[model samples]
Target: MRRDKDSKAKADRHALLAAAALQDHLARRLRMPGGPAVQPSLEPGAPMTLAQHLNLIPRPPPLLSEDQWSEVHLRSRLRQDSANECVICKEEFQTGAQVLLSCSHTFHRHCLASFERYSRAKTCPLCRAAQYQKRPITDGQDLFRVKCATRIQAAWRGHAARRAYRELRRHNPPKDERLRKKWAAERLQEENDRLLSKMEDEVGDLDSLFAELDASVAKSREVCDAALRPLAARLQQGLLREAEAEAASGRAAGRLALVESDTVAPAVACSGQQHLALQLGRAGLGVSAGLGAVAGAGAAGAAGSGGGEGPAGRPASAAAVDWDAVVARARARGTQDCPICLGHISRRGNEGIAWLSCTHCFHIDCIMAFEAFELASGGTPCCPVCRSGYRRRCFT
Candidate 1:
């Protein structure tokens, strides 16, 4: 009786298993595609809504073939003022799978897909237009690019910041006292070395400048010496010649004065005696015994006083010879003009022409040069033209 009960139980278990299998199959068929299949075990929740169903089971995005996408992109290129690159990536369009929005903007498909996945929106990535008609295309071209413009810029900026951080850490002083002192000493030494190098360079430039200036100064001095040598020599020669001329003139003037005094003394005395005899005869007085030895010139004077006679008031044919002698003496000292300067001697103001005892005349400035030369050379000043010893003539 126990065996019979066991067999009946096995049969009942088999029938229950078959019913469970059929129910599982029916449940699998009845559930919506991509919706939750497993029912809650503990408690039944609210029924699934249409929005929830659509959220779970999204529709597949549309795509175009390579030929169709190429034609559209070519058209965009031919259009005036069309963008040549994707704005999101900031990279030129490499022939690839891309998306064209309804707002007329285009982008790399992968880049836009990434943006949509993160933002969870159907809006245009560039224009922000909702309910956009996205036309995804397959261009069958090189599409290796993946980095977006923003991410690339962020990475570069991060790299720079990290590099700066590392440099700052290296430059900053450590906590250890010994190391900090060492760092400070090293920095100080480097700065001192740099300053020393700069100073040396400046000093070198200064030395070069000094050398250049020295060369210029030396060259100028040499040029001056060469140019002035001849002038100095000529001036010295002229000064010596002037001094010698003054000395020679002093000697000549002394000699001429001696000759005039010795040779002409007796003749001048005889003429003075003859003039005294003539004046006495005019007064009917006898000639003196002192004038007796001057009888020869007295007779001549008497003849001269007779005016065109020989002696004793007689008319003389030899009067022509006496007239010629007087004219010859006058001709020896002829001119009224100054000999030193060619200008006529006309007394003007306080500083006028000067006449000498020898009857030579000179302009003041014209004769001053020779006078000054003779004075400076320790010789007596003499007349410039005639080399005669003279004194200033007093008109009064």
Candidate 2:
């Protein structure tokens, strides 16, 4: 009978604890006056916080520092109204008032300043929305200064890179991998030596040849000058005479104009048409003289002994690439397949078009693949089909 009682007591204790837990859960689901719903305790015997009991506790967001808040206040202070009014206190400007405008609504600077200091809140006190001022990046003199600084930094970096390259070149010698470069350099040096010697020998020969040629040219020039000097002198004399005649004629016209003006006034110019005709004729003569001088200068330039008559530097015509011939050669070399698709060529018309200088052509996808491959190889692209030095226009 005693064992039976003990077992029954233990079962009653467990039943009581289960009942307590159930009561706590039920209390959480039910709301209480002046407070949130209660929550069941995580540890049965532990003390519970009010939030834990109410299940209404929220995770806090990040907090801003006082300095950041001060900056926000400063930005807000920039938008002051003409009539300064305190938004929070609703006071007329009895003292110095700073207005703050955010989201098309104005606020008193002191109101925002107080909230910023005490509340640690980024939201507006009025609407509970995020506070922001119209703080656009200024395109002022400082911006130009910043841009100039960036360019100067870039130039400095370039100069440093070049200096580094030169330093490395000066300090480092050849490695095993650079044997080919060393050999090329040695070979180039020998070639340069030979070329120098050959040039010296040729220079001596050229000097003699040029001396003879110079003498012949000088003699020919002297003969030509002797023959043409008389003609040039006569032409120069004729030009001077023409110029003198023009000056005399202009002076005569000027005199005539003065006489005619003295004879008539603008109000009584009924018979001044003859004088106007003479003035027009003189103006025509002046124009003719200018044209004549221009023509004479052109003729003199052409006839001068200097070789300025020779052609100036003109670009050579680009050599045309024979697409048909290139296609034929590619076909002969058995490279007539699309490299990417590995599809056989159907016909040449518009199936693929080649770049002007290259032997390869392909579908658009193949060209893009070739471009990627070329980028990987870190050099100019080879032909996609035959690995020749060729490229083509790619249009999808």
- lDDT tens per residue, model 2, 89-208: 665433333443344344546666787688885666656666444222222233346667999999999999999986775556557667658856866797899999999999999999
Please report, in order, the local distance difference test score of every candidate based on alpha carbons: 0.49, 0.45
User: What value does the lDDT take at residue 214 in candidate 1?
Assistant: 82
TM-score to true structure, per model: 0.26, 0.19
Q: Model 1 residue 171 lDDT?
A: 91
Could you give candidate 1's per-residue lDDT for residues 260-335 as a string of tens digits? 1211223212223323334333453322222221222322333334444323224332222333343344347675
- Model 1 is weakest, by summed lDDT over 10 consecutive residues, at 255-264
Residue 9 of model 1: what lDDT?
Answer: 99
Which residue ranges in model 1 land beyond 4 Å of their true spot? 1-67, 70-159, 166-171, 243-396
Give per-model CA RMSD: 31.9, 36.8
Number of clashes recorded per candidate: 0, 2
lDDT of 2 at 313: 15
Q: Score candidate 2 by lDDT.
A: 0.45
Where is model 2 poorest over a 10-residue stretch in terms of lDDT? 262-271
